[model samples]
Target: MITPLIHYIQEHATFPLSETDISLLEEAFIPKKLRKRQFLLQEGEVCKYIAFIVKGATRQYTVDEKGYEHVLNLCIENWWTSDRESFHKETPSIYNIDAWEETELLLLPKANGYYERVNIIPAFNEMRIKLDDNQHMAVQKRLNMAQNYTADYRYEELTKLYPEFLQRFPQHIIASYLGITKETLSRIRHQHLKKAS
Candidate 1:
């Protein structure tokens, strides 16, 4: 479980982590497991931790007044999920995060100076900076796709970039993530199959 996170840190860190740095990480990250459909954070709760997925899948979403869930993000193994505003500013989150499958996570909590201790490591600090930049770019691209691109184009890009999502998630979830109706997603998939055949 921890090995995956250790590997991720090693891969991302600009410098090699010392033994002490590894020990700090081990101490800081608390391992947690979630059953399928279990909520990690619910709407109106302050998000106290940032979770790194070790295995399984999770989705971050919001419910409308009519109780329809609008998917904001779909995350899987090696992905990080949190409401940044809620976590950093200690505010209530409008979004909910839940596990789509039985999941393992390493949680970095806001309490006890754990985050501060970990960030003090030069290699970890560098990795965090890099991750923030990548996350920013991904958010910008996703916003562009949502605001400007056609649904078909968005679906195509999703297929190209994260084909595993098609296999791992249900059609309704995929449709929600794409901001399309399930019927429209079915139609688009059928059309693609026709073109392929």
Candidate 2:
């Protein structure tokens, strides 16, 4: 469906799409719905489609040898999610992505023919939008920030970047992303609140 995806493109695309471009997108993208906790991707599966969220949320995570889940990212409406390495390399994914709520998504298949056809449409150049490189850079930037800044600084930066994240995600997951223990995060949050009050 060209519904939410089109709106997302209009909001975020660097270039404008024409009627023919929309038609091409409609033909290429497949729509799907998932119930809460349903997995869009599982560890060890090849990710064939990059999904754009239309509604609800999803989390990408990995379980360690000790079985502790480490959150890599959370995707809400208008966000894109996929294991880029798996998708591009046609290899197994090490991460899992599951719906945090009942979700709607538009899936873009990763095939040369599909890409070629879509690239023929305006504002659809893969070269201009390198998803994998962007994703890697984002993760790297977050890691660098975590290493160099105090927890308070990192938390504030995250809040500025994703305003709804604190309200939407659990504290433990947020703590994990900040590379802190839950108790440490609690102390930081409490201290911040005390100062605000």
Largest TM-score belongs to which candidate?
A: 1
- True-vs-predicted CA distance for residue 87, candidate 2, Å: 0.4
Worst 10 residues of 1 by lDDT: 1-10
lDDT of 2 by residue, 11-107 (tens): 6557788888888889888899999999999999999988889988999999999998898888898788898789889999999999988999988
Q: How many residue pairs clash in each candidate?
A: 0, 0
Output candidate 1 Cα RMSD.
0.8
Q: Evaluate all candidate structures by whole-model CA lDDT and list the values in order.
A: 0.94, 0.84
* Winning model by lDDT: 1
- Each prediction's RMSD over C-alphas, in Å, is 0.8, 2.2
Misplaced by over 4 Å in model 2 are 126-137
Prediction 2 TM-score vs. true = 0.89
lDDT (10s digit) by residue, model 1, range 1-197: 67898899889986898899888899999999999999999999999999999999999999999989999999999999999999999999999999999999999999999988988998888888999999999989999999999999999999999999999899999999999999999999999999999
